[model samples]
Target: MTTNLLTRTHPRDDAAPVPPVRPHRRRRSLGSRIEPYLMISPTVLLILGLMVVPIVIVIGYSLMDNTITNPTPKFVGIANYLTVLGSPAFWGAAANTLLFTVVSVVAHMVIGVLFALMLNSKTMAKVPRAIFRAIYILPWIFTASVVAVLWRLLLDPSGVINYLLESLGLIHEAVPWLGLPQTALIAVTVINIWSGYPFFMISLLAGLQGIPSDLYEAARVDGAGPIRQFVSVTLPGLKPILYSMALLDLLWTTQQFTLIWATTGGGPLGSTEMLSTYTYKLAFNSYQFSLASTSAVLVLAASLVVAVFYVRRQRKEERR
Candidate 1:
């Protein structure tokens, strides 16, 4: 009887009235929900004002004629795009940009991977590895303008490069590297490769470190040589990082302006002209803002495509 009375007391609460939530508790819950949004509002506003608004304005300008300079700009409905698309100079710039971007990306990958492998070598002493890493990363530490100026001096007709070549009998006379159409693009590309590879090297080095040592042990157990193990394990492990970095490098290299502008100014008969240079010339040099906007929009579209791939890759990695 005593046990039955003790267990039965709580069952009567189902028939009793329920307690209501307090107003203070409700207000606290609402405040908690709103706190995160309030904290991020400033950043959200900044992005809208800076990036999103400017991109929207540029897209709007691309669809109009005589933007900014004229008070009454007329809607041209893609006429600027047509003009830009039909121009041979635009095509030439696009071609130059393509070649420069592809070559730089490929060279960066090769040099970065090689350096990463060298640094990752178990045979390398710590002191030598640290020294080599610092030296290799030195180019990346310099600003684009500095890199351009340094390379310009190095590639000048009377520069140390020419002096060395002459002393070594590699060439009979001084070569104006940036002044010649045949060598301008190649020179800038080499310069870019030198400046850009450190990023890849750093990224790939981290990726290589994350790879399981057990994988290498397993590969050796199967009678795999160094080359075979690298091919089977290292490459596969680094593939995601490689793809993501390549896409980012492609986007960045395509939009490269300061280095090219400071070095060659897209000169030597337009041999090194890129889309960015073409857009800049149209807007500032020729005072053709509408056409420049169109070109800018086109470049944005290409960048967006690469960005989408990068984002998708990131999402896939997160899922794994």
Candidate 2:
């Protein structure tokens, strides 16, 4: 038996060990490669749907004779664009929108910076600081619709504004704030400033907080007063934040809708008409979707111009 076992071929001893196949190895490599894309897919799809899709639709509509009355959209090329550009109403709205954006941005910058400075002051107690912060940001908490409605009630002829004015002998009679064409645009612009200033204020406050306290001390040591210190240290430090905030705020103010709509509906003979409100009027009220789309395209183009200018400015600043 021993001789037979020795002569028999020992397969196990002579053969090499085989490695088992690992199916999951390839799967793991693939998962690692695709994981980042999978994570960002939702955001990409959302942006495509929300921003790109609407822009494409607007462009398409601007080129077509599209309206509610006309179920079938016929391609009209640049006719709609030409018509919109030639329309007096369109030009008027554009002018108003431009003026409103400029005025509102300026007001926001001034008021916001002041508020931010006051908030950053060292004299305020902790409780008062907290309270002031809450109060200052309160406007931002309210929706544009709510703000518009509230302000409308206040500005009504028989409302608290006129009542107080009469009581103080400021005006012998109730003033027609919204009814007068002269005051309508200004009124809406003021409301826009009031509601929107908080955004700038918050941004400026953040910028202020990030500034090193030592810079102020150094400025003071160099015989700088409050104005000089602000001009040199504060403004320089806030430059980037200010630029970003102002550009974005300009875009938002120009596109503002709900507040102006709820207050005046571009009323008093379209005195308060803006690009945003005018677009709304053209679309739903007038059922001129093609012209509305044209307006939208123009506004988008203008906004792009602003964005390009901002990009250029930022590049120059960076180079400096």
Candidate 2's residue-wise lDDT over 1-320, tens digit each?
88678767454576778989988999999999999999999999999999999899889989999755688878899999999999999999989998999999999999999999998898998899989999999989999999998999999998999999999999999888988999999999998899988898889999999999999999999999999999999999999888878888888888899988899998899899999999998999888888999999999999998888788878988898
* Candidate 2 lDDT: 0.91
Model 2: ten consecutive residues of lowest lDDT: 6-15
Instruction: Put down candidate 1 lDDT per residue, 1-320, tens digits, no spaces.
Output: 88789778656655877798699989999999999999999999999999999999999999999788989999999899999999999999999999999999999999999999999998999999999999999999999999999999999999999999999999999999999999999999999999999999999999999999999999999999999999999999999999999999999999999999999999999999999999999999999898999999999998999999999999999999
What residue pairs are clashing in model 1? none
Model 2: runs farther than 4 Å from truth? 1-23, 309-320
Whole-model lDDT per candidate = 0.96, 0.91
Model 1, CA-based lDDT: 0.96
User: How much RMSD separates candidate 2 from the native structure?
Assistant: 3.4
Error of 1 at 41 (Å): 1.1
